[model samples]
Target: MMHPLSMPELPSGIARVQFEPERVDYAAPEASGRQGGVQAGWPLWLATFELEKVDRDSADMWRGFIARLRGRQRLFLASDPTRLYPKAAPRGFAGMVRAGGGAFNGSAIAWAQNVDADGNADIGLTGLPEGLALSVGDFIGFKWDATGAAAGTYGRRTMARVVIPGVVSNAGAVTVGIEPPLDMLVVPAGAIAHLDRPACLMRQIPDRSSIGSIGTGGALSGAVLVAGQDLRP
Candidate 1:
């Protein structure tokens, strides 16, 4: 099985993502009446995200995140919703985020309710109403709670190994059996967990809008920022 390239979670704010191909076609008179085409360039993938209430903290965080990128930094991007737990190849791509965008946005917030570290413990999670659609050998990202006493000793951020396939159990549980059986720290109750996937380095577009007024206080209300794949020949 082709494993996904381990990558950090996408910054919160992305509400939707899209993939597009950059191609060109031409016909050579001498070659015949048949038409041939070659890839104009690498495929272009775009991710759209929104900035919540637009608070100072959120705004600063977004600004810092982008500023740190310096417009051409390589970053991992995984926006495919269908292949959350890819079983075969084509796990994810490595690209650069196009520059020229100044839209401010934050990351998503999620947490797990309970966890166990037995031979193959089942973990329960919250904020995932649709449950998870995962396969064996997939990876799950976890951020240990800062307040947890063991946070200092154990790695705060780590990936969990998925031992079983299929969606989360009817009780909203997923089974994990860490490979190598290292003395892995148990993810305490209320820790954050997210789906993991391989990522390709991408460049952030420098063109973006300034912080704007907040819209309705609905869950879907926020600003949309776009990032494109940075292709290199």
Candidate 2:
């Protein structure tokens, strides 16, 4: 297996970052021509990194990073620039991830999918401070399995975005909606919800990546679209 490459943050950072879920399905044409579809694969993320227009040095730096990627031949770790922390006071729990500080015990103490044991969009996060809530669009990450193996988590870390708004209960638990449900083949267990540094393993789309001077002078504007590598547990 090829090792995944770690990429530096863009020199000029990103002018924009767009995220979308990629769902695959097979069309099941109905007798009356009303189309029905069967899901073909688990959901994954499609991302677009809009490189900011910048000075020659910055443009060159962008070229250097893109060049190292060699256009879709390698994998890199990427995350939503807008989702480094939750949208609330204190914002995150990584710093105080312990018995006294916060709920981040790191042993997957209290984490599981909600409503359905098999797997779904909703997940239950335990060990949070009472009334602590995650807003829609906030991100969380976790991976778990009965055997406590990466094999159950599609062999990699998975990041998910909250889709429904909710608050933690007095018991320090809350259930919220998430998109692109983590691929959990067996019942999920020994799980922990991460509120910091959520990221996706991605491959650049060669055809969609381009960079060069786009306006007057030596300034450059560029963009690249990366797709999450679909994995099955």
The CA lDDT of each predicted structure is 0.40, 0.66
RMSD of 1: 16.8
Candidate 2 local lDDT, 49-79, one digit each (tens): 7776667666667777778788877777677
Whole-structure CA lDDT of model 1: 0.40
lDDT for 233 (candidate 2)? 30
Model 2 spans > 4 angstroms off: 1-3, 10-12, 32-35, 55-60, 89-108, 115-120, 143-155, 186-192, 214-218, 230-233
lDDT of 2 at 60: 65
Top candidate, metric TM-score = 2
For every model shown, the clashing-pair count is 32, 0
Task: State the displacement of the C-alpha of residue 117, model 2, in Å, after optimal TM-score superposition.
Answer: 10
Model 1 over residues 52-112: C-alpha lDDT tens digits? 5554545555655555555545343444443453353234322311122222111113333
